[model samples]
Target: MRTNIIRDEHVTVSYDVVNGWTVVEVDGDVDLRTSPMIREAVIRLLGEGHRHFVLDLCFVPFMDSMGLGMVVAITKRIREHGGSLRITYTPGPIVRVFEISGLHATYQIYHSPEEATQRTPSPDGLADWPHSPSVKKGS
Candidate 1:
């Protein structure tokens, strides 16, 4: 069941808990105008004690630099709270933006939401392979 759903003029954000991971699905362009709403939704989830996160971005067709910054900020805050966040995106504008900005290597991105959850390493959903601090920082 969906825990929360937020609808704006340009965006739709919803989330569900699947196998200990909170799957946040975004539908709309993530730009300066819409990033705050998405960020707030995620912060609310984090406040609710949902530690594991998978940002499912297949429905998000466009994301500007502000959107990416919001993601980075969210990830940082999640880690500060001892939580973890990952991303899942289809091959499209969002993926292309990440690639072009070199943020793809900065994030553990999956091609599908199933893969995102399947690769979750623990009940708390923290994985060692990617950017987790427990892992070697830049190896």
Candidate 2:
């Protein structure tokens, strides 16, 4: 894993590439203050031929509308180019926000970065689904 830090006045975006996945672990607040930087970093990785992404939001304290918008925008961009975004290890508060806002339904959420990176495409082969046995029917 290789970590890259993109620091600014209000927030810092730390990312790493492991195996074939680019895991972007975001810290600090992601609001109007820092969404652009985050977007740029993710877009750059996509431009560099990274099709799989794991966004680890375990350390993020807060994410506002701008942050949510950036995520949606990035997801759309990835889909346009036949890519995917997996959010993993997000804290309860952040997870709640995503759930409440319906973003969780639009994106794949995982318990850990490793799990996210290891996920395979769903039956349709266009989206990702949980690999755990818990996802099985009648388990």
Candidate 3:
């Protein structure tokens, strides 16, 4: 039942545990000004012993390379710690960024946080999916 919320003009990061997964929902733009904040929050959580993470980016309207790099770094750090990171609820523009950078394939993405937590238990485990496919409009 641990929950933490951090807010600023550029972004808001909130963390909670859901169904044994650590859910981090981010709202607002993620750019150079905000990505550091996200990194700090996530790193702090990692220090606190959180492993499984679902990052919901549905509310993020825009992101730049810095933001992407921060996410990539976080993912690597989590993996190095024997943890997993799933990105959920990505909006179209962000999805495009992920597609362009081939991060969609690098990261396990889902339509919702619940799905991100539940879907991998399926037998296929996303191995059948393509790498960085173009996101369908309205998806």
Candidate 4:
């Protein structure tokens, strides 16, 4: 497995390939200030010929519209290249944004990184990811 790390004052991006999937783990707020780090990592991974991605946002407590937009853009690029993107470990506020923006159903979302990799995709090509066990049935 190959590993790469990028750190900024606001965010840190680290990734490695496991079982043919590139797992990018972010530790920080993914707002306008930090989206670039994530974007660069995704672009670098694409350049490296990775077709599957798992974005682990477990430690990201906040993500503004810019961050969400970057995620959407990356997803589009990956799909254009016949790749797949799975998002895991979203914080509550971030998850709410995704739900309110009607994006929860668009991306494959999972409670954990392990779940993200193991779940099978639904007919629509999105994984049937369940809510995090730590989160209650309804907020």
Candidate 5:
């Protein structure tokens, strides 16, 4: 089930579990104005005992440095608490933001929720689920 914590014109933040991982879907622009909502949503999920995450940013049309900062900060928080974060974004401005900021290499980013869900998280926070057989090692 999907639970929405907040929604407005600028952004909509909601989350649900997929393959035992919390999938937080952001369906709007993520900027200085909207980043906090996303962050707080993740924080709430974390409080609910979620340790694995997939940040689905496919719907985000735009993002700024502040948004990137928020993502990094959120990642740190999750890792600090012994959790894992996977990010997903379409090939567009959102990808551009990560590439320009040189964060694409830092994140376990994917193009779709299906892709993210099918993969394993970082070594420390490995999920109990098995990754897709199609996934080649060290790809």
Candidate 6:
């Protein structure tokens, strides 16, 4: 899988696609400054017919409310189009936040991008693939 770093400060945003699944990896901190870049990338990918996404945030130092909001918004957009979003390789802090806010239940949390991409969508969902786990979350 190829990876691209878009912006970097105390935080960095990178994205890559593998087997039709776009994997977004966020390193450092994801605060107000870098969240917009992440949002834009996801939107662009969606426009390009990439419905399935795996957001890997294992290296992220922190993610504020805005960052979380962006994720939720992207998930909503994908769902509106009968698509799905999966979050994998998230760090403990981010996972705790998602769990506490009940967002974890709303979005599928996977151990790897491959698993996330292979998940079978619901009856009203878009598509699915054979389960082939290949995503590595943390460093």
Query: Which runs in model 4 stand beyond 4 Å of their true positions?
Result: 119-139
For residues 49-132, what per-residue lDDT tens digits would candidate 1 score against the true structure? 977888989899899999998888888767766777778888778878988887776676777777777645454334442343
lDDT values, one for every candidate: 0.77, 0.71, 0.74, 0.73, 0.78, 0.67
Deviating ranges (above 4 Å) for candidate 2:
120-139
Best candidate, TM-score: 5
Residue pairs with backbone overlap in model 4:
none
Provide the lowest-lDDT 10-residue window in model 3.
119-128
Q: State the lDDT of candidate 4 residue by residue for 20-131, as single tens digits.
A: 5678999999988889778888988888887788888888899889988999888777766677677887568878878888777666677777766664332223232222
After aligning candidate 1 to the native by TM-score, how far in Å is the CA of 6 from where it should be? Answer: 1.1
Q: Model 1 shows how many backbone clashes?
A: 0
Q: In model 5, which runs have C-alpha deviations exceeding 4 angstroms? A: 120-123, 126-139
Sort the predicted structures by TM-score, highest score first: 5, 1, 3, 4, 2, 6
Per-residue lDDT over 61-126 for candidate 5, one digit per residue giving the tens place of the 0 to 100 score: 999988998897888778766887778888888978887887776666778888888755554652
Cα deviation of 57, candidate 5, in Å: 0.4
lDDT of each residue in 71-139, candidate 6, tens digit only: 867767776666655677545787777777766655557766666666443434323311221322221
The digit string of per-residue lDDT tens for model 3 on 5-93 reads: 67876678898787667889888988999898898898888899977788888888998999899998887777666676778765689
**How do the predictions measure up, each by TM-score?**
0.85, 0.80, 0.81, 0.81, 0.86, 0.75
> lDDT: which is higher, 2 or 3?
3
Residue pair clashes in candidate 5 = none
Which is better, 3 or 5, measured by lDDT?
5
State, as a TM-score between 0 and 1, how close model 1 is to the true structure: 0.85
Identify the candidate with maximal lDDT: 5
Q: How close is candidate 2 to the true structure, as a TM-score?
A: 0.80
